[model samples]
Target: MQKGKIGVSSDNLFPIIKKFLYSDHDIFLREIVSNAVDATQKLKTLAARGETAVSVENAKVSVSFDAEAKTITVSDNGIGMTAEEVEKYINQIAFSGANEFLDKYKDDANAIIGHFGLGFYSSFMVSHEVEVVTKSYKEGSTAVRWTCDGSPEYTLEEAERAGNGTDIIMHVNEESEEFLDKARLGEILNKYCKFLPIPVVFGKKTEWKEGKEVETEEDNQLNDVAPAWTKKPVDLKDEDYSSFYRQLYPMGEDPLFNIHLNVDYPFELTGILYFPKLKNTIEVQKNKIQLYCNQVFVTDSVEGIVPDFLTLLHGVIDSPDIPLNVSRSYLQSDSNVKKISSHITKKVADRLSQLFKENREEFEKKWDDLKIFIEYGMLSEEKFEEKAKSFFLFKTTDGKYFTLEEYEKLIADSQTDKDNNLIYLYTSNEEEQFTFIQEAKNKGYDVLVMDDVLSTHLINKFEQQYNNKRFVRIDSDVVNNLIRKEDESEHLTVAEREELSPVFQSVCPADNGVNYVVDFKSMGENGQPMVITRNEFMRRMKDMSKLQGGGGMNFYGDLPESLNLVVNTDHPLVKKVLAEKEAALSADLETVNAALAMLKAEQESLEKAKEGKKEEEVAAADNEKLEELQKNISNLEGEKRGKLEAFGKDNKLAKQMVDLALLANGLLKGADLDKFVRRSVELIN
Candidate 1:
């Protein structure tokens, strides 16, 4: 027997590997199994080159657990290390400038492990003692055994003869006794070796015997050896891709569609990306895209590797060129990753465009299920935004669909405003906003249905993307103003508006944190007596603030809602109210107006005299007189308004009109709505 220490510049190497080399010690199984695969692959390469004399037909790797002995072994029938090769590869740790390297990278041990070729040593992380019994394939070569107990020192000695191969036997440590469990070992093997190019066996297949699962004689292979992504796209059928998706996500719903990526020129990347039925919540479905390196499972948290929006997609991405840190625990940013991300974004856009071009009716049929993903991608990725325009769709309230260009053309002539800007009318709820939608349709305009959770952000993005284009909700304004074609003619003179303003104000609801403004517009006599509209800018800000939940926008979300009470001057009911008010308050309003005119003329004369003068130059006596006159005029006006308010209170028509408008807008609730119902009954009677 010959024994020596592992050639390392530091005595603390083993401790570091056990404690910090990998973020999670569970990765030790992946590292060991990967090494075994590498050995198997290399032997196959040499045998194919006619450089090896041994038969290569029955090559395989196997993992087994011994509960009684508290040991787990990974064996491979492939090229094994000779004693001399072990001395060079296993004994000598490849890290140069050991002290400085450790000092500089101790905090980044997980990343440094792959860089310094410490894969084999990771076995010590979960085992108190590890033994490597290897027999080289070289003719006349004797078998050798290497044993170490989580230390720098090791023993090398001659062992019993065996077929050419290697066996890694680990005596599970007390802290890591979980590795000794048969089910645990099977789980680790399945996770890391599920798609390996070579078959990996772990115990025998099981069958239901009596009432419990019993082992069968057939070997239970854990990996597919040739997953779907490894094959060419032309060779795969639609069902093949779908079957692979089901294999990856057993419990996921049927995908809406998929994008098969197989690129070779810029960077080697192959994967099947499935568009799952994403929940309205963006967070609950993220990190479902599993990333792989040469069929070895790296991670599912592929946020940086793919575009942020693509994280909502679920599937497997297997690429040998993706850069992985030491333990493959996470992704490292590099040019290849960026190129891959851009490629994926392009592929996704291309697939959607193709589907749309092939059969638009089918695309529109699936739009509801696929809306959030496409919108998110367009909103977040600029390159994707440019590509998405080709296939993006807008569904009208009437259940018709149009592309961006097509929709713009369909509404360009009529929806264009006096300012030459095109307006897109949209409704959040087809049922709740049915009245508003019908009104818009009555004006020869189409209203779109934008009810997705991300619609607020998406429309905001579209406004920036297109020139002279605006998205207006159906209920945001009166039908005439929604897409104004020309300047509106005055329906009521200043004197007539002043006489009626206070009457509506008195009957309008009190401050419920909602600011109400009374306005008059001439729709024909057939228009509704009253309707409510909201300012577009303020409403959008509030909606976006609720979605973003941050910054000064949140202040907008907390502010009171403001609505406009639009009374139709042409409606017979509103006209009747105005005529009644004129008859009741005409005498009182006439006297107040005469006195108010005299006080206003005097105040104007005084203000004209002081127009260009500084405050000191204006006489204090004149200022005082002007203030007294203004106060008297204001009091007289207040008295006039009081008379009008009293008249409005007594007139149930005014209150009923306001309630009708509120009800149209879905704002009148509870007692107020009940009052409207009772008043309507009495007025009809």
Candidate 2:
């Protein structure tokens, strides 16, 4: 027996390994099992090269634990380390400038483990003592045993073994005794080694015999040695990709499609990415994309390794170029990782473009499910945005799909405004905004359905990306004004508009958090009598504020909703309401208006006298006289408005028109809706 301390400058290495080498102590199994796999694979390579005569046909890694004894062992049938190799690889920590490395990475546990080749030592994280019984495949080589008790000190001695392989036996510490549980060990193995190239055995296969589970003689392999992603894309069928998806997500809905990634040059990368069916909401399950290094599971939090938007995809990504132990910050800065991310984004875009080109009808069927993902990618990744334009679809209200370029061309002649701006009309809800959508359709305009949670942000991004293009919600303005080709002629004169404004405003619902402005537009005799529309910019800001939840946007959210009660002047009902108001309140309004006119004339003359004069230059009596004239004019105008509003309240047709607009907007609810319904029944009776 030969005993010696591990050749390291610091005596505190063991404690550091046990306490800070890994964030999660459970990763010890992954490290040890991974090492076993490397050894087994190396032996296979040597045998294939005719460097060794040993057969590697039965090569496998097995994990077993003795709960009573509190020991877990990982054994492998492969090229094991000789005593000299053990001295060089295990006894002597291979990291140069050890003190500096330790100091630089003491706070970053993951960086410490992989950066300094401390994978084998991770076993100390869960073990108070660990033993390695290895036999080299070299002819006439002696088997050796290595023992360490969570310290730098270790014992190397000759040991008996039946085969040329290695066994890592860990005496789990008290805190990590949970590893001794069979289920726990099995879970760890399944998570970290489920797709290893080499078969991994956890225990014996079981069967339900004699009304109870009985262990069979067959080894229960925990992994698929050759998963779907490891094979060539041409060799895989659609069902094969689906089956792999089920293996990754047992309960998830089947994905829309998949992109097989197999790149060897610049960087080694292989994996399958599935476009999962997503909900309209952005509150999705991210971190579903499992990342691996040579099939050894590294992490599921692949936010930086892939573009942020791509994290919504589910499946596996195995890249030897990505180090096993890495921080998100390191991944963000790594040049190779950047290259891999760019390649993945391009591949995804190309795959989508191909799918759209090959079967556009089928692509349209999947557009509702794929819109959020494609839009999110376009908003987040600039390169992806450039590629996505070829496949990103604009789904219209009538269930037609068109690419950005296609849709732009289709609407160029019809929807372009006099300002040379192309207008893209859209609706958030097909049912709620049905009236607005129909009005747009009546004029031969195509309205898109932009209902995803990210739609507002995406629309903002689109406006910034394309010149002379605007995305307007169909209900944002009256149809005639939405894509105005020229200045529209008003049907009512200034005095007529002023007299009718108070009448329409009087019946507008005084709902909390709602403000209504009466507006008039000539929409011809066939148009609806009244329409309620929201301002596009203000509404979008509020929508974004609700989605993003903070910052200056909150100001928009907190403001009352401003809606335009657009009264179509050409409609017969509005014409009747105006005529009725003129007859009922004409005398009272005339008396008030005559007094208001005289007071306004006096006030305007006084205001004109002081137009170029500073405050002190104006006489005190003149300023007082102007203030008195302004008060009298305001009072008389209020009196005139009061008379008009009184007549408006008595006009049932006016109230009915306002209610119809509210009902169409889906804003009439509870008592207000009940009132409207009751009034309609009374009028009909």
Candidate 3:
């Protein structure tokens, strides 16, 4: 026997391993099983080169628990270490510079283990003592044993003969006796080593024997040695890819389609990416891409490796290039990750393009379910945005699908505005915006169904991508104004327009934060008395702000909602209103307007001299003179508005007109809606 001290520079290493080396003590099993896998893979490489004579086939890794000995051992048949290799690898604790490295990587230990080669020391986390009994594959080799007891000193000695492999025996600590439990060890093995190259045998298979469960003689292989991702693209059928998906996610629904990535150029990458039926855009999740190094699962949190948008996809991404230690902090740079991202994006777009070309009707049928993904791709990834427009689809309110070019051709002559801008009218809620859709349809215009969460951002992106083109919500304005063929002259004068606004404003429901704008449009004198529409720009901005991580829900959201209330002077309701006003208060409005005009001139005259004046000099003259004019104007306008509001409150025509508009837009709710319906019956009667 040979006894010597550990060759680590720091004596506090074992204590560090016990306390801080691994965040979770349970990961010690992963380190052990991974080391066994490495040794096995190296043996295969050696056998392929004809360097060793021992039979390499049927080599397996076994994790067994012995309750009597209170030890769990990882045994492998591979190129085991000789006495010298054991002394070098086991004696020298190749720890990362903890004092400096730990501070930099306090948040994540990804680089720590991979950079410092601390795979072996992870055993110390759960073991009170660890022993490595190994024999080299070289001919006529003697077996050796190296032992350490959570300390700097260790013993190396000649041991009893064993096969050409390593046996790592960990004496389970009192605090961590969970490792000695067969069920617990099996779980860790299944989690970390389910797809390792070599067969991992934990225990005998079980079966029902004479109406009781019993262990079978057959050895259970706990891994699929060749996962589907490891297979060549031409070698696999569609069924094979799908079966593998079920293997990875046992209960998930069948995928829509998949992309087989086999890239060896710029950087080594291989994997299968699946497009799942992601119904809700808000429910789209990240880390669905399971990243693997060789056949071993590295992590599922592949946020940095794939683009933020592509994380919505589900499948396996096997790449030797992706480096992750025990703690998985993604460390790839923007370039390598960008390459992977661009590659995946291109592959997905190409696959969709291929599918569309192969079967047009089938593609169209799936567009409703797949639209959100394509739209998100177009909006979030610029490269995809450029490539996707050709294959991207637009589904009209009538349920017909069209590509950008196809849709443009379909609506080019009819929906084009006066400036020749292609106006794409769309409705969020087809049922709620039924009036707007009917009006659009009546004018021989097509309205698209843009109702998804991604639609708000996507239309904005589309407008930017297609210059001289704009997307307008179907209910954003009155039908005539929405397409805006040519601006029709308003029948009412400016003074008459201002006069009617206060009347409708009084009857409109103020809660739900609604505010109104009164505008005049000549609707051939027969249109509805009032029509309400949302401001498209602000509405879209608010929608997009929610999608792109609503920073403060209060900011843009707190402002009172705006609606356009259009009045047709030729309509009977407004005509009746005008006659009533002429009989009641037109003379009063003229008097108030004249007084306000005089007061505004006096106020403007007073503030003009104070433009460049100092504060004291400005205050020296007529500050109150300007204030008096403002107060007097405010009083006159208030009086005029009050009289109009009182008239609007008393007038059934005004309330019915605004309520009819609100009902058309589906904005009137609860008691107000019922009252509107009740009032409609009374008006008819």
Candidate 4:
């Protein structure tokens, strides 16, 4: 027997291990089990190379817990350390045996998992004392038992063992007693070691007998020694991949498609990525991709390992190249991580491109569900954007899907404006903007359904990518103005427009956070009598603000919505309203206009007489007369506007037209909608 303090530069090493070695105390089980797996794999590697006579078959790692004893033990059957090897590796705190093993067996040690020797110390986090009983595979080697409390001091001595292996026994501390529970220990094992390369046993398999679960003789293996990702892609079928996905996420829906990633030249990376049916919201669908180093689970937050948008995908990504101690800042700067990120982005884009090229009809069927993810990727990753352009689809309001290039060709001849810019018409809501979409379709223009949360940002990216291309919402303007082929003239004169503007403006909802600007356009008698449209730029900005939801963008979000109330002058209803207004207020306006003309003439004459004159040179009486003339002119104008507004308020047809436009835009609600219904019935009657 021998006793000594652990070799270390600092006396605070054990305290650091106990308090801050790992973020969670439950991680101790993973560290211990992973070490056991490494030991077991090392034996297999040595046996394969004919370096050892030890049999590698039926080798396994088992985790058992004693509730009353408040202890957890992880045992394995593999290459273990002799007494001298234990003194060197165990006495030294940071010395890693896996690293030295890899240096010796660099070519054949692919399955070795441990990179940091401190993994053994992690057991001290949850234990008041930890004991290791190991027997090396060397012929006539003596078994040894190593013991250490939650301190630098430890004991090593010869012990008895059945075979070559190691057993880690942890006496649970007061605060870490939860690990003594079998169920809790099983959960931790399932989370971190469920896909380990070695079979991991927890306890006896259970059977439902005598109306209760009874432990059977069969060992209850907690892990699948070989997961789908560890096998060659050729060996996996659709069902096999789906079964693996179910194992990863028990309650998740089946994925739309999958990309089996196998890269070895640049850096060893093998895993399966599945494109899940993402919800319209991006945040809720993130952090589903689990990352691993070799077969040991690292994290589910893979934002840095893959691009931010790729976080939307669900799957396993195993790479020994990615260090086990993951930090966001470290991942961002690591060269290997950058390469892996680029590779994943390329893989996703390539898979999508293949799906589109091979079976476009099937791809189109899934476009609506796959759109948000693709759009988010294009908006976030530039390299992905370059590749995604080949597979990105534009879905029309009529449910037809087309690639960007194909749609560009389809609309190049018809949708190009007079400025030689290609106009891509789109609608966020097909039902609410049905009138606008139909009008566009009537003119042989196709409208896309850009309704995803990322659509606004994506369109902005597209606009930046192609200066000659523009994305215009179908309801952003009248059909004639949406893709202008030539200059157009207003059908109503200035005087006529002035008379009609007030009539439409009077009925526009004032309390709603919406500002309506009345404008007249020539759409022929066949066009709708009224149409509501929003400014594309402003609306897109507000949409982006809502999606991003913070910072200076809140300004745009808080601003009231502004829409164009386009009244078709050629429509018979609008013509009738103009005629009716003329009959009702023309006489009253004329009387007021005559009085305003005389007052304005006197005022202009007085202003001409005082031209370039000093204030002192102008007569006091002349100034007083000018002031009186201005007051009378102002009063007459007010009187004229009052009569026009009064006539507008009394005009039911004008109010009904405004309400119809509001209703079509989904803005009219509550009492206004009810009023529109009642007024609509009366008008029909």
Please list the C-alpha lDDT of all candidates, in the order they appear: 0.84, 0.85, 0.80, 0.87
Report the C-alpha lDDT of model 4 over 1-685, residue by residue, as the tens digit.
9998889888898889878768776788888899999999999999999999899889999889888988889999999989999988889977889999999999988588888888899888888899999999999999999999977788999999999999999998898887777788888999999999999999999999999999999999988888999999999899999999999999999999899999996999999999888777675756588888888887787877888888888999998888556111133348898898899899889999999899999998888788889888888788888988888988887778888889999999999999999999998888888888888999999889888788888889889889999999888888899999988875667867776777788878889778989898988899989998899889887888887785778989988999999999889998999888878777887877788778888898999999999999999999999988888888877777777778888889989988878887788899989988999899899
What tens-digit string does per-residue lDDT give for candidate 1 at 1-685?
9889999888898998888878877889888887777667666666776778887788888999888898989999877878886787688875322223346445432111133467778899989999999988888878899999978899999886578888999998899998888888888887777988768999899999899999999999989988999889889999998899888988878999888889888787989999887665465665589888878888888998898889989998987678876677878899999999989998999999899999988999998878888889888999988888888889898788999989999998889999999999999888888888888888899989898789988888878877899999988877888888889999889977777888998888885678888899998788888888888899889988988885878888988898888889999999899889889888888988998899889989998998999999989998998889889988988898898889988999999989888887778888888888999999999
Model 3, span 193-253: residue lDDT tens: 7877788988889999899989989887789988888889999999999998898788889
User: What TM-score would every model get versus the actual structure?
Assistant: 0.91, 0.93, 0.87, 0.95
Give candidate 3's TM-score.
Answer: 0.87
Mark the regions of model 2 whose C-alpha exceeds 4 Å error after superposition.
Answer: 95-116, 324-332, 611-614
| Poorest lDDT segment (10 consecutive residues) of candidate 4 | 324-333
**How do all the candidates rank in terms of lDDT, highest first?**
4, 2, 1, 3
Candidate that beats the other on TM-score, 2 or 4, i.e. the better one: 4
lDDT of 2 by residue, 1-685 (tens): 9999998889898788777767777988888887788778767766766879999999999999888888999999888879998897788774422234346434431112233457788888888899999999999989999999977789999999989999999998899887888788888888888988889999899999999999999999999988998899999999999999999999889999999999989898999999988889764666699987767788888887998899888999988677434221123347888898899999999999999899989998998888889988988889998888888888888788888888989999999999999999999999999988988998999899889899999888888878899999999889999999997887889988898898999999885569999989998899999999999999999999998895879999888899999999999999999888778877887788888888888888888999989999999999999988888887888878888888888889999999999999888999989999999999999
lDDT of 4: 0.87
Superposition error at 437 for model 4 (Å): 1.6
TM-score of 4: 0.95
Going through the candidates in the order shown, the clash numbers are 1, 0, 0, 0
